[model samples]
Target: MPESATLPSATTKLEYLRKDLEDLRYYLDEFSAFLPL
Candidate 1:
């Protein structure tokens, strides 16, 4: 169970998650200008 973070599946999943986060951030920034805050 140790060092399981190096698994190929986990790495790919992490990449996908990171990409999604970046996309979300970009969209948020794009729309934030129209927000009341």
Candidate 2:
């Protein structure tokens, strides 16, 4: 309900999302290099 209380959870969620996106990009890059486009 309070903005202060919700900030940490939002930050943690963003961090997780960022890490997942980074991992996906890394794998995609590796896969793309082996495939012709």
Model 2 agreement with the true structure over 1-37: per-residue lDDT tens digits: 6999999999999999999999999999999999998
- Candidate 2 segments exceeding 4 Å error: none
TM-score of 2: 0.86
Give me the displacement of residue 3 in model 2, in angstroms.
0.8
TM-score of each: 0.76, 0.86
TM-score of 1: 0.76
Clashes of 2: 0
Score residue 17 of candidate 2 by CA lDDT.
Answer: 100
Clash-forming residue pairs, model 1? none
RMSD of 1: 3.2
At residue 25, give the lDDT of candidate 2.
99
